[model samples]
Target chain A: MERMDLEALNNELLDAVLEKGSLSFVVNRLHQALNKGVLICDCLGRILIGSNSEIEYDIDAYIAKAIDHSEAYYYDQEICQLFFPIGWGKLIAIIIVREVKEEEIENILPVLETANLSLCFYFSKYNAIREVENKYKDLFIQDLLFNNILENEEILAKSKLWGWDFKKEYFVAVIEPDNFINIKTFAEELEYITKKLAKENDIEIITSVRSGTFIVISREKNNQKERVKEMIVEKISRANKYFSEKYDTTFSIGVGHTYLAYKEIYKSYQEAKTALAIARLIGETKFVKYFGTLGIFKLLYKQEAYLLKEYYYETLHKLIEFDKNNNGELLPTLDALISNNMDIKLTAEALFIHVNTLRYRIRKIEEILRIDLSKLENVVNLFVALKIKALLKLHYSDID
Target chain B: MGYGFLFNIDACIGCQACAAACAKKNDFFLGFRRVQKYELKYRGKNVVFYYSNSCNHCENPECLRRCPERLYFKRRDGIVIHKMGECRACLTCLKACPYQAPKFNHQIGKVSKCNLCVDETGDPLQPKCVKACPTFALQLVHEDYYQPMAQYYHLPIDTIGKSHITQPSIKIIIPPELQKNGEN
Candidate 1:
């Protein structure tokens, strides 16, 4: 009898275990070599694969007992049964052998050990492959979320394989941590906790992390859009509170409107991303934001980049040119003035400059641009132009 | 938890010897090794700099995650290697990488990149490029030793969506001129 070299088995069989039909081929080969019926089952004793007639036996109780003990067992009687545990504790399968002879039991022990090792290899490789597949699914979801130009058929096929129903109504939620050092681990933890909440609340969710941002696609269980939005918001808030306390960090969530179709869900993702961006831009104090609440900025953001750039240039081109030519602080002064609600004293204080110097810079800006800083319309235009410029900068600076 | 590379930019003479040796050792016909020379004007003085960079073998590699074919894997000692046979020619990893490590092999219709010469020499051994450097510019150092140098050099540890996002494992020594001028 050849003693099984466990190290050699692992080294040789690691990659082969993930190949299709390999497990069945291994089990069949083992069955022929051992001259006994073989059955492979999951931890729950559900038969996954088998060879010969051993699978017909109702050995679930024996398999369960073996799994509970996490050891091998044999019935000392005619037509003996043998149960061997495969895989590590809490995650294992059972290999059942039927009609074993008492005299052949010693000869069969080594074969069963080899078979159990092979099964363990298969389970480990299966888990790794499944993880890779899940990552691929997440990448596909990201493409959909960003509205990448994808074929409908390809989307449907990929989603079907991942067990996701995109035809149903769904909303996108973007969760971002304030200061996360290990984003991958954080994303995994967030996904686990969020999935638990979804299960308890009877909601469906598909989550992916891209560029350190946690994206979740929540399936709307009811037709009421407003109610779904409220529920999602409440659930996210609770989750955020728990995670913030647990992780000793802050979390901000952005929610997008629910859409009915797969293609249209990208718009929801875009909205969620936009909301998150706006929240980060505004301040960290407001931890949650919704796309529906960003009335004017949403309209402004939707405009063509060139059109917005033209408007920005028309309004602030002179100041920008002056600043570029002389490396002046005119733009900063103007920004401070507008941000401080046109208060010269406050603007000067914010810019760390004297009021007289502030006045001089403001006079220079007005003289160059021919726009009065005191007028509400002019201030609004300058403010919007600045916001548009910031928006464009953000859009351009975003790395793929 | 493993080893990383340290590049002393000041010691590099822009000879391209490391690049040539790497290409020769790896049989890289399409030029896998890149040596970039840049000029900067600082404090009324003209300064020239040379940067020899390859894959950083990032802690959280975007190449591994974004590869649609799942061809990339990290070894125990942190060297990221890719299987060319499994590549789908998507080039998503190319776009996702901040350092632009992975390159397209036009002839083969797939993507290929530096594996830190893991096939030729395993972990705890000097990579081909590090061994080939005439100036002793490239040294394979432990992560603990490299982190402080990276911080002192003020090398941008994180780019908006690239090295920072991926947590690349490579460390750099800033050019003396840039350090003097407080520019990186």
Candidate 2:
């Protein structure tokens, strides 16, 4: 292709930044005009602009192909540098079609320079604003946690749009993506959707990356909590429906009980996360409400919240005791117990132990608890008991 | 050993000469001031200050830590350089910095900072800040002695905790106040 009309490109870019208040639009326009069979992508790996040829722009397909090629094909394309452009450097993709003369390079210098300027302005402005916003968020959250000044309902109420009243309640919804999904994409999409939903409701959505999506829907009246929750569920269902149609993925949402003020927000966040976890276990493609999702824990534990606690304590405790009594044999025994459904004979074979010795240990366990191990109910009960025990221990211990 | 920086609030007339020189030398985007002169009041007195500031090449650099591309490098001599080839222009490092040091190019997602002209064609020892400062406010001093001199002068020391603890090998001198005793 002949050298791009540098003056025209420069004028176009300058006008774009000044008039449209954007640099990407102008750069994309330039790339579209070049018609050099070059594909131009923005910083985010999104195809901002490109010149058409036999090849079509499919970022997902490219990503999948890269995955198949084992990260070695990075050198084959000029656009590969888009993965990492050192501080403020533009990556130029040169197709080996022609040994473009130095004069041509010089000809496009003005356009390149102007494009460079516009890019710099946008980047600097974005970073400056983001820095300020993050700094303020950090300060605000830290203040809320350490200061205890938010505890004064009267003061907090005055700051609220509708005066602070303890009678006011907020429902917390925590959104979690499945393990197989891309975390950043999911988070960004969820944020966009939440913002859109908030805008429709005329409420500004305040979000932070403190784990996953922790959304607080403020309601002044007690009766409104359920109504807001229904709205949230309806919105999420619509979002999931759209996503399934577009990308073939399901979304799960966990909701928490209403809390009076911001002080109890952390607790609500935790509950929502737990609900999300339960929803994961009951996995399907649609959005599942987590508040009362699981009945398995109640049935398995006998006592509410005790099932998880007992399950961990018994399994771990048995391992520790077995390890202490027979120092060398505990690892194999623990492994056997976990893998073999705590069946004495099966566990013995898994551990390469004699059935008699496994039986002896079962006898020792019976002696410790005076409970019979021969029954299937006891074995099933013990397994769940051990799991719950472990969970309860982790409930207090898990940080972040 | 690495790149250095200098900022003299007192000597800065805020003519934007250093900034213009930087842009010219790097052929960088216009109106993007890598070396900015900030005029603000300190203790109610009109303090004419210039931050001939860009990258501090800090000891515990926040930009290095938060950068997703991990493109930044700290030379043994203390110059914090970035390999733009690896930059995705995510700007996480830019947000993490307390002193707005990283310059962003919006057309592309890349970021740039003052490299003290180490890799550029000009005199390697003189950064654009020092070259452009007509009042001699910014200077790229030798590390062996200049660092201590900078600390003693209270010249916007970059080698302090939680800010930029690395001792960049330069000293920025603010001229004594016109009516103050140290005036020349």
Candidate 3:
């Protein structure tokens, strides 16, 4: 009679994994199944999905120890905490069971094994589906960005395969993840969280990965540009803050202008890419950037190479030359100061130098350039020069 | 960080001291350093400034790059030196150079120009023109670091012509009189 009860419970947990497509749901199911506080963590032992239960042991060190064993299945009773290293071709997660006596772990072992089987099977099936979906998604994205063969009707027809409405106006955004320890896990986790956020925000988005970068497309029927922008920015900001706080993930998103026609959507995508490049150049990679509001940069980037070079020479070339000759740090110091709104203390902190050192650099810059940093005109000159210099580097990469 | 010349246009008083100093140092007919004066109508008043020009030893040295005979080569320090011994008087560099840097020497029947006053060991000696400027206008500086933008309130960029082509190693600090457009 108890064997039948276990079979039914395992069936129910499998059903939840299939239904919710979330590890947390399975985790919650296990929490009820064993009537214990349960949680799930990734390879780094950061809780990907869990309840508010305080862990009694250092999960990271334990996870490291388990990895050293190189075994598919690892179960060890350590005081009140029971760690189950679930694996099938990949170490998907490590399940931790809390508030359980060491003797009770023997009884819970079978149930944990059954749960592990269901999760492995679930991920294998999930990956299979995603692979097929990505195959079609990449084709559509390539067609939109490069092919330009498909008409508006064709685009709409293809978008419907993924349940996306390309008929409505849309904006394209490209995000590149940076400073990650593991790319595969980060991308997987980011996709899941982003999709969840999209659903919660009631925003229609089609996300696809291409060449290790995430491309998110949002469809909006609203005619007001600002409203659509505000809505999209709010959604993206929420996602940015969410990942940054939880995983310390740093990424930059470049958003394109709104386009009404489906054919025009590709233009926004192109603009978004340009904006992303500009963001990287300016060292402002932690925020969402829109093409329209890029100010003078929008106009400046398209200028002829000679003009860009001439402009750069006019402004910051002196400081650049000094740094090159003397191996000085004045140019970067000036850039940090300008980027940080001329806040000396913050600039010093960003450069990992003392405040007095930064001040000395600033004074040297003024002395060499014969311009007063305290004056707004001189600062603007320096600022514009820096922008032009960045553009010059992009335009004339072979100029060195 | 190649070598270049920095000229303070406002500080220059149309004095040919740089030209005279160059004449004495290099023994050239016209003195390699060329000083020109210009008048700008700003704030309903004519503001006069002197522009001293020379071989910029460009970042993209057209004289060296385009020379079929390869008579020109830029020093590691950014000075463009002309090898008169290898000169075929091709004049390809003369035409290719935007600043009219490669001058045709009728006396030698070959192309020639300022070599930045090389010493016995062929290293530039920071030409006497820079040292001769009485108003502390002309200066010898690193080519990459000393580039001064012409964008000011007056925007004197228009007067400097065809220079955008060569990307020369010259820095011109436009005077405050021309930079301030809101002056009375």
- Candidate 1, residue A231: CA error in Å? 5.6
Clashing pairs in 3: A314-B148, A314-B149, A317-B145, A318-B145, A321-B145, B3-B77
Give per-residue lDDT, candidate 2, residue A256: 61
- What candidate 2 gets wrong by more than 4 Å, as runs, is A1-8, A11-20, A23-58, A62-116, A138-148, A151-169, A175-190, A196-204, A211-254, A260-266, A273-400, B1-184
Judged by TM-score, which candidate is best? 3
User: What's the residue-level lDDT of A251 in candidate 3?
Assistant: 78
Query: Quick one: ranking by DockQ, best first?
Result: 1, 3, 2
* Residue range with the least summed lDDT across 10 consecutive positions in model 3 chain A: A391-400
Report the C-alpha lDDT of model 2 over B1-184, residue by residue, as the tens digit.
Answer: 3345655557667777877887887675732344454454433466555565566665335565456554665554566667776678888877765456677877667887766678766544766657778887666654523342312222222222123122334455545542223432
Model 3 chain A TM-score equals: 0.71
Query: Candidate 2 lDDT (Cα, whole model)?
Result: 0.51
Q: Which stretches of candidate 3 lie over 4 Å from their true place?
A: A1-79, A93-96, A147-149, A179-183, A220-249, A303-307, A316-337, A340-378, A391-400, B1-184
* Model 3, residue B22: C-alpha shift (Å): 54
Residue runs of model 1 more than 4 Å from their true location after superposition: A1-196, A204-234, A237-249, A252-367, A370-400, B1-4, B43-46, B58-83, B86-98, B121-126, B134-136, B140-167, B175-177, B180-184
In CAPRI terms, where does candidate 1 land? incorrect
Better of 2 and 3 by lDDT: 3
Better of 1 and 2 by lDDT: 1
CAPRI-style quality class for the chain A–B interface of candidate 3:
incorrect
Candidate 3, DockQ to 2 decimals?
Answer: 0.01
